[model samples]
Target: MPAFDAAAEFDRQVRTLNALGYPALSGRTEEQFAELVAPLRAEAVAHAGTPDEADAPYDPAATGRVPFVLVVTRALAPIERTMPLTALHGGKLPGFVDRTFEPGSLERFVATEEAEPPGRDGVHLLFDVERGEEFCGVVPNDAMAAVAERGRSLLTIEEGVALMTHAPRILVKNKCFSLGGSRSGDRRVPAIWISRKAPKLGWCWAGNPHTWLGMASAGARRV
Candidate 1:
């Protein structure tokens, strides 16, 4: 498994944004880019709180648009291909080979419901199985909902009496995209969030979602 390199990933993000003409972000050096995005990253860290206090009782209402830091490491071997599919309900999750299309954006990588097309910009990468865990970070229910609507899932099951299963993971590479802040009632909410910008600009379900009730994630302290 590969280690998550935040600095390298940050450089990649700056390059992508530069290539895409992201307003004033173009033509900046990697160091310069790092300097520019450092505050945002710091803000993410601050929003997530101390490592020990994050991802418990996932609560987005309170976080309100603060950004969080996340380390994007390689997936575990057994279920490496099985990405954790986020949904309002597990029933909403797509089965093996099932694909769904969602809006595309430059903020992060986008996946197509259909299998790899001839010239589509998006890629069909799998999600990390360890997503939504405390070690990764907290992902609020609303964030999960936001991901489910746009993200696609794929699962493989063996044809047998007991039905053995194969990997099931979400894509985390290729196209670019971003998560819109969660909403409460009529007002839009912005909470701290994190994404892997290198291998791809995407979010993982590694954070423990159950802990988001009144906190960011399971085990996270309520601020």
Candidate 2:
């Protein structure tokens, strides 16, 4: 298909946010954006706690080898894909796992593989880091397929959980973009009408928020 135009998308998001009562975000420099969202960031910090105090211990075996296994499960759909500012402007929106998606019982896992090919079946993408590299396993093939979708998927396998959790919290508290979408059956598909500029920071439903949010509040926070 056509390239995803990042510049146009960003401008459109800014306009949408303006209409929604948020300060304009389109033209602001990263620093300016930071300032505008400072309060929200602080709120996220309070909720998340300190980096050292809030995190789980490190594990060495998670990343020592390649092609790690993970007990994958469906967490959330349409998580922000990590694309560089240039790539976005050039029109290449990718995919990333929704940080919020952890089995209510198990919140940790790892991956040794780089991520499955885009159309491959299975939960091949990685998220939640520990030490330099780590991997884990999950069951249910659809979990993998849900995480890997039509866009460029940016799932990090080796890092720290802080990065995984903090990144989204920062964006949410900063009022980056809220999750707005629809619920089909048990699955929540994001609303496409809402414009999301920072596709890497948080999950913004793919379309109109009103239809989704108005019809069912269930999908409001799933992302």
Candidate 3:
């Protein structure tokens, strides 16, 4: 998988924005862009969770509009502040754009949802063929043994037989997408699952900042 690089992405966005005849941002230097995107990237990392509960479907109520605004505003601040008024007021640029120093001004620009539902809580578990008592959670030992036995039995069965079997197959489905679909179009939801003894399963929703930023920068490209 490719690594995430917010600064490089921001730099690319700035170049694209500059080319579109948008007002030249004052301090939109590569270093400045790096500074701005670093926090967002860090936020992304810190927020990482199981695939079932990644950053997807951002809760407007939980995160609010402020953080989103801050990200955009900070990313654009140097550009707005350093760019000359002539660059902004001239036909070269549109009028709706203006520089402001007020904290959280960016937050006001982005919209957020009115409400969100709470996440479900559950414990992580791993069972082996031996059905040792080392497992956790409220499930009794015999019940767990039965579950393991059933799982082994299913795995042993032929695919056709498994399909025909009415017994409930253990299915672990992450609901991150369902939650994310409820939010805005551009947000992302990244999640992961850390099994007790196995490698983690990772997943994400639409919260690709690069794609989202690219789209927004494209809008700015329109002179």
lDDT by candidate, in order shown = 0.25, 0.24, 0.23
lDDT of 3: 0.23
- The most accurate candidate by TM-score is 1
Per-residue error for 67 in candidate 2, Å, reads 26
Model 2: per-residue lDDT, tens digit, 1-223?
2222323323343343344222322344545543443333223233322344234322212222111111111221112211121112223443234444444311222221332222222222222322111101222123223333422122322111112221221221112221211122233332111124433422222232321121101100000
* Superposition-based RMSD of candidate 1 using all C-alpha atoms, in angstroms: 16.8
As a whole number from 0 to 100, the lDDT of residue 175 in candidate 1 is: 15
Candidates 1 and 3 compared by TM-score, better number: 1
Candidate 3 is scored at a TM of 0.21
Q: Where does candidate 2 stray beyond 4 Å?
A: 1-25, 50-82, 85-135, 141-223
Ranking by lDDT: 1, 2, 3
lDDT per residue as tens, model 1, 1-223: 2333334433444354344333232244656544544544433334434444343332322222111222111111111121221111123432221122123211122212321211221111121221222212234445445444545221111000001111111112211112222122222121112122111112323233323211121111111
